[model samples]
Target chain A: MSSWRKLAVAAIAAACIPAALGFAADKGPLRLGTTPTAAQVEGWAIAVRPDGQGLPAGSGSVKDGDELYANVCASCHGTFGEGVGRYPRIAGEGKLTGDRPEQTVQTYWPYATTLFDYINRAMPFPSPHVLPPDQVYAVTAYVLNLNSLVDDDFVADRNTLPKVKMPNREGFNWIDPRPDTHDAACMSNCRPAADVKVSQTAEGKTLTPRTTGPLDTAMPQ
Target chain B: MAEQPKEQLRTAPSSDRRRLLRTGMGAGVAAFAVAASGRARADDPSPPADPDWSQSLGPGIGDRVYGNPSHFEKDVIRRNVPWLTANAESSISFTPLQYQQGIITPSSVFFERYHAGRPTVDPAQHRLMVHGMVDRPLLFTMDDIKRFPSESRIHFIECPANGGMEWRAPQLNSLQYTHGMIGCAEWTGVKLSTIFAQTGLKPGAKWVLAEGADGAHMARSIPLDKMLDDVLLVYAQNGEALRPEQGYPVRLVVPGWQGNVNIKWIRRLQIGDEPWYTREETSKYTELMADGKARGFTWPIYAKSVITFPCPEMPAKGPGIYEIRGLAWSGLGKVKQVDVSLDGGINWTTARLHGPILPKALTKFTMEWRWDGSPALLQSRAMDETGFVQPTLTELRAVRGTNAIYNNNSIQTWQVKPDGSVFNVQLA
Candidate 1:
């Protein structure tokens, strides 16, 4: 093919392909997926909202929850929700201030619905979303009772779960008022020279992973 | 994260284990030398004779259908802190930032953060559902989603807890551990706007709850405004199919937002009238304040910068004129300027920003400095286009306190000793 003819041919090919491809999209969105059936949607509709939306038809007592929690979650969360290993503890002193405030279910979690949502959607470690809604509700109620947010006989259903008011429900500030710090790009005398003292160092802490020399023999601290 | 603050740190191994570790390392080195027997022997003439490589033809292309970094670069792997999580399956790993050169983090060493374990999802069976408050609820197969208009964008996905460990002090001793919970990569996918329009969002659809198909069913509620602006349903990253660690077949890329919001192995995007307040958002990602009140929906990653070359892992080799390199970024906008401080924050010099300076992407910065063999505190501070400067640790603590274990973008300082060794440090 001649160079001029090849250029003309290439232009036509390039122009035609996108125009054809974009025909549906230009009109609107390139609606590619199928409109799912009610059954299909139900299979994946697992989210439970703060207002009690998306809750399934089931209930569980704190008694049942305690038994279920022992069988399924005790290995990591501990017997009394005190936490095991590096796993987060479920119980706390209901305190939110200190050198290191423990933000457990008792102290920080604001919504009880979130407890049910998380347990139903993801729980039981290595294997999650395996529990039925009844079991999930039971576990959620048990955890609520542990946090002193519910009575021992209290049950968590689609109706009751959202009504369980948490102690720290009003403790959160919703908006992020960032640009919170006002450190400008000052070139000189940003701070006094003496103020640049090293407050502390990680040298003697032995926390750093070693790279070479005899220090390399040491394992991670 | 599961244990108390102090208990979360790894205790040193017993001295007997250290002796065993030394013995194990010696054997590894000896094995490596034996494996490299085909290379030119030490006795086989230095410059007088050509090396074995020049004498023999190299392996053909078919030897490795998929290419990898050189064997010498084996040390450049993502490493996880032992005490960071309950198990390796649901933990975080740090990218070796000291070894990284440019803004784009290689997929092999990209930082990893997972709520549950990494799921081996097969694309053939994977389904992406868009339901809830929409005109036309739909289910998309992988191929179906890819057929729409697609674009590739380079943006950095950062875990808000990137520097959470050092909220109070400089505990983590390396740049990788301190700031490696982020990775900037080229994400190629269809825009959420394109898909949402197809789904035809109904009125009052204010939030889109994205959920992953991983074992944890990880989910987060993102506002509609941000979703319409830059959210993408990404399947390809860095010019290839997404790495399994980075949500293989498909994922959601909420550029500039907290990394947890970028749902990996994404399966569902439920358009809703209100936020679901999933476990990640309510219990995990929220930042606490000094007055006992916590802050929820803290999304944007503020301006931040760190000097990589003089970090603990990459120490100053001798004291000569050197190009100090670092990375600066802002979740809100472009990194406008980066200031390098040799003697801590007392004196500062502007660094030359290079590479693609795209908004919400990692920007590389370089500055020339001469180290006169004297001990110095090295620091870098970034200012974004929004006029928000990276704050000092003192400034952040005065407001947010040490307990807010997320969004610690304070100025990182490295104490360079006179002997050319570097250590992580905090300014008084």
Candidate 2:
């Protein structure tokens, strides 16, 4: 009896989705999408899982990465992977607990495989995903080395990249405990009107747009 | 005392701000002065017997078949802060909220947040490949998607880091920069669950990794349960094919989630067991707390609002009887009530919800204020049906700290000077 019930459920799922659409359907399975060929699916499967499940077969060393980084990434990521103009700082042991915590990979990133996955899929902006697997592995190794997360002569591959221990790996395990701060919808006597003070304005250095002068007409005309 | 401003009773489905400008009434040029936000002075020269438009035969109708806003609205385009990103191509721009009146943000001027530059995707060439953990992997074209039953619903897509710059201080002077990272639109698309029925989920399919076709290939992992709940593979917005910037051919509309999760130019959705902690999920978007530890997957936008009329861009003009208008929204559910405060949140008065108040969508709220030309700090607090009251900046920062670059839904305060000029300011 149980076997028949299981088969019955599977049959309904394989048939048309009458329940999902809130209507009756005589057609068996709306099946609109084309059955993809293996190559068609493989061409777009670029995501790299945390366990290094999708890492392409290739390897590179810190030494090779240094040269490759200079050639392709240095223009935007800076020579030492510090950063350029407004580009993000790639490599550094920037502190996390500060007024302006520098978001460097070594300090903030949770997984080392993320670095490889990102560089493999999207890197060296203006011409992203142009790097071969070997170059991506090399660039990944050099960036990890620049942050002192790995040794000077470290090599990175599918096996090695997943094993790399990010400093902030365990830092992101907290559940988002929100409605974090709950405030009552207070009506009156919320606070003394005199207490409110303009602690800060956009007029702070380098941030000012317009203060007292005629407001820049945001008028449509 | 003056009569309490009448609540503009809304019977129709959708009525925007520009059309509802009859709140202030007068006659002839004076009426124009009152209605046009004092743009045309009442004392200006009276109109001639026939104006140029009325006298002359304008350009033919063929000149503008695909209609656009009046020429006067040309300046009301998306504005970006240059200092925000390393390159302009991968950056974001803000909606001119001060000029925008209705709850539904026009598709053309919708705020843009693209990881890679916007791609002009051809629907003929585009295909959405669904594979990985599924009973039958399939490749869907635009026609294949539209073949399935479609749904149209209104929702707002807000970037998680909408007000990141104003975390430590009120750093952006303009309302567009501070609060314009949100846009509401009526999206038409097939529900992902309906399509997933064709490609049944495999036994271990716990998550779905959605990847975009942008140069960045921006990908984010969404829980399978969420995908089956309300996710839509959208192709149209606001009664038309979606604007190219909003993902022309198709995009993922993870209703009520951050804009990033609503992957634009979506090409592939690989159902999987584990979350794909792509560059966007881990290296960015995660909210870094005060302890240096960061919170991951902080998705829902809490109740939030801002007084737009007296904001930096739309400052008050000799504050008389003016309709104080603003927008409020929540990801949890429909906005239950919106309270406006002229004195920096010291007290609150419930404002009238002006238009259709949909779930997980922008709800326009308005309050009439007879200003006495006094310096006041204007603020609005939104409350969702979930009973979550919008918290102050102090309350928000106290829990998340000043470092949470994402999910800054704290109430915003606009300082109205005695001269009727408004500026962005944070109360101490």
Candidate 3:
């Protein structure tokens, strides 16, 4: 039998024992999940959106963020938010137009709330989800200051966050305009041989090691 | 380039080729087949020999509680492009697609993407909290979750940036590097809707913030409609407990969506009215368009297919009625049909779909091919049940431009030379 079938049989057997022992068997939708207190919710539920809905009641200044960023984020994100080794540059370039566009906070991101949410949840590379709300706010402010979106002393909080307009605020479209190419299921003579051109070629990098051998090699001769 | 391969190809009928696959022959046997085909071909073996029976059966059964792949399959592993990330913790790895067979990808080498690296979580201590807009905020232990109605379904989790590296140019060399950010497996778990029904979602609960228990606390705002659709709070992958690299105790499996949104080490699910606009959704997964504008919430992976054989890694071994195999899939729905092109996009022929072609799962396809030892641009075009055919590289670039890194599910091409060598190439 399949493993899932075995698991289902085992689960049924486990559930029956409770009723057989004359214990109060759980009812209604398996009766799983314990009602958690407000304190329990406070331990992990932290997420901020574009509308500043989840922004905590805390204030932070870009000036304070600059010092904190240097002490914590500079090693990986670079002192100027220029980025070090592919760690994502928070500033410098803006609004990708060139062939190789640098997708930084100042240029690409449509919302400032994303900055606050990311830093609080996943940041600093080595350690994450440890930053207090104020530090996250300060860093968000500092990143915005670097992007020239806000002044250095600008304090960001729940109310002030939604009001801060991003440069690419209106730079996003909704509908997925796909099935763009109208290449029919042409069976034969679709394109001329001369028309076909080799546009790009592989870098020839040996990314994956080749597997070609017996399981066991050496033996005690 | 070699006389032996051409002569062997002329001698062997197609039935012998099918027998080779059915026997589950080792690489040496396959190598001998290739060697008999040609000396210039890959795996140029010296000669076949009888097994040294005295050396065999050294280790007894039950020696290892958890078994691993054959020692020869050491190279069949997840690999990384070192230059992609600053540290290994926040890096991603590619699945060995060319080495894989059928639909299910082995749990061990299923591509890994870690935000704060794989967390070592004790299942006993792990807890799943469902709060926010729910009528009753609930916390469920591992044991409590298993009691819910369980489901087992085969689905594929694909990273949106599967072919993102080759957006501008064909950079990677192998099939694994190009289309390895995907894995299909039978995931067994409780449906999120089943769990949410008990929580009783409040009136305007449109979205839910799925959070992870890892150090990164990785989070993504998923639509309730999607959560109710097919999303799973998975604890087991394939037939065993989930690999630590793929969220051990619990993880959210957002079927048909980008892999990132399927948060690993999932801890909390906060039902809310609006999207959280997390960094993952905004800065990372968003697609940058041509007009300097960007598009967000672009989730579903479109129709895509790639030639597994004759790929850079596994080139045509002096081609003789070879079973040209590959994988075809679509996040939209089931793959309705797949067409193979031998001469770029000039001519097309239907390839047979193998195994159970389930929705949102990898579908294996094969075609009987007789290579004439000529330079050819080979490609596969996949069309889903939704009638959305996989776009060509040129067509994809024309619409999306080279900037949109994620969701490059275009038809991939493998240029096979007369010498039986294959190179990744883009044709116009």
Candidate 4:
């Protein structure tokens, strides 16, 4: 009777093994879950398109922006939007197309949306993204006004922010278009096969490679 | 050459003692001269030799407890541009590649590139919350993370824009700016898989959003597959707590991904069905191709290598029996081979690779060369274990048009002048 009972328990355990494995395999690779609500997610979702797709519904005049700039942005970006230190100045430094030229926002930035996007995402010296949407718009407007790209009365809101035209819109070009060109000079025109040159200088005089007589056997073992 | 004279001046007698000694020597020598003048005599004249290192300070204080590099290495320092970015906040500085030798960049001298600058985060207040499509939304403290089984691996983290300057004409003429956005460290952390297992991942979760506690609140959406496969919640690097510049308290170490995606000061990990489409995903990091449409989700940085020594502005020391050294890394895996070409790209010689060539880690390569004072163009080509070869600048431009400013990993050439000065030059 005991043997029969043990057989029955074994039979039951065998039946449950596949089911447990199947249940584990059914769940795909990653653990999924719900995201935060729109309000809760607002802090992480601030992407303004060139056409102002995700701009918030808030408005601020250029005058208000100017005042806000003086109080906040001007300390580092300069009163007239000229950059101090590594902080990029807003006003134009003209196009620098030399071999090595500074790529500043005023001279090389392609879109006004980038300015708005960057400022909205990462700004202020101490606290980043702590500003409300209206303040971001106002600061953007003030920077634009200082850049001479916008009017004093121009109000930057969800609609007007995208319409601002930057001067260096076409400043950047795409990567070069060229096939991998292998130089014949490297392939076939390498310096003629000559004997390896071995020469040295001692006391400002050139010397040829010549082994002296006898190896030093007195060296420590 | 000028150092010998300076050393002599330093070793000379003190100013006050030298004056007194000179007066005494003059009086004695004059008296001796009068005696010697009367009788013909011959004496040898020679200056005393300089003293050895032991004569000064006898190994100095604290020598028994700690050791430092030779005093000759004092010139090595991390370089930065003061006026490049405004203020200490939201700036990027470069590493001095020319000054470094090995594949591993010392934590102290590692380059710092911050968006909103380094944030002072208190570890006690730090909490990592994992929510979303899981059976249980779990919140773990710094101590709670330590309880889990941990693993350590040396990995190399590189910025996607490391070689951005080379996308156009060879802009800056140094490997430091061209390739300094990379660093290697032995990171120790708990596997994200363990954490995901505790949360009980639900079916259909595809992406995970990792967020930081910095002022910028930097965040990025990583594919769920990669997260479960190899992601790590690293707390220590090089056997020490994470450096403040790299990440302090805890950071999400995404092996073989862009530097920005390895979010520092990581606070939240939300598992989701689709990407969050955060600003970083939609606008930034996306490569704007030559075509009007942009290429989104260019995640894995490709294999790249740069010859650090004998680079432009770093002259070759009259070239005979010189060591050719550089760094090679790949987002894919170990660097299988690195070829050094001295005569332009004519003959390729395999370099001797050093260190444990682990997956997604920097591997140092070296080769010996004998130069004969002739102008030679030097270049390095790295091939990863994945069979992906490092291409030339011309080849990179072909696939990714000249318009793109990021992910420019091409074989860089440095023209060595006869006088030993090297200049950045492109070989077609």
lDDT of 4 by residue, B1-428 (tens): 44345546664444533343345533443433333333322362542343222112222344356455654465454444343334455555566677777767777767776767788888887777787777677777788887767889888888777777556655555566567777888899988877776676676776787878777767787877677656799999888899888779999888877888999988888877766545565445655554433455666667788888877636798858788889898876788888888876667788899977878888889999899999887888888875667777766766666655667778878778788887666654
Ranking by lDDT: 1, 2, 3, 4
lDDT by residue (B261-363, candidate 2, tens digit) is: 9999999999999997888988899988899888887777888988888788777789589999999999877899999888887888999997698988999
Instruction: Give the Cα error of residue A200 in candidate 3, in Å.
Output: 2.0
Which window of ten consecutive residues has the lowest lDDT sum in model 4 chain A? A201-210
Q: Write the candidate numbers in order of decreasing DockQ.
A: 2, 1, 3, 4
Against the true two-chain complex, what DockQ does each candidate achieve? 0.32, 0.37, 0.31, 0.07
The interface root-mean-square deviation of each model, in the order shown, is 9.5, 7.5, 9.5, 17.3
User: Model 1: how far is B378 from its true place, Å?
Assistant: 0.7
Q: Per-residue lDDT tens digits of candidate 3, residues B1-428?
A: 25336436543434534444354434344534433443242464743232222212234455568888865466787877666667778878888899989999999889999988899999999999999887678999999988877899999999999999888888878888789999999999998867866777676667889999888888888777677667899999998999999999889888777899999988999988888878887778888877777788877788899999878878777847788899999887788999999999898999999979998899999998988888888999998877778888788878878898899998898998888888888886
Native contacts retained, all candidates in order = 0.65, 0.62, 0.62, 0.08
Q: Cα lDDT of all candidates, in order? A: 0.83, 0.82, 0.79, 0.66
Task: Please give, as one word, the docking class of candidate 1.
Answer: acceptable
Alpha-carbon runs more than 4 Å astray in model 4 = A1-121, A132-221, B1-51, B55-68, B82-84, B291-293
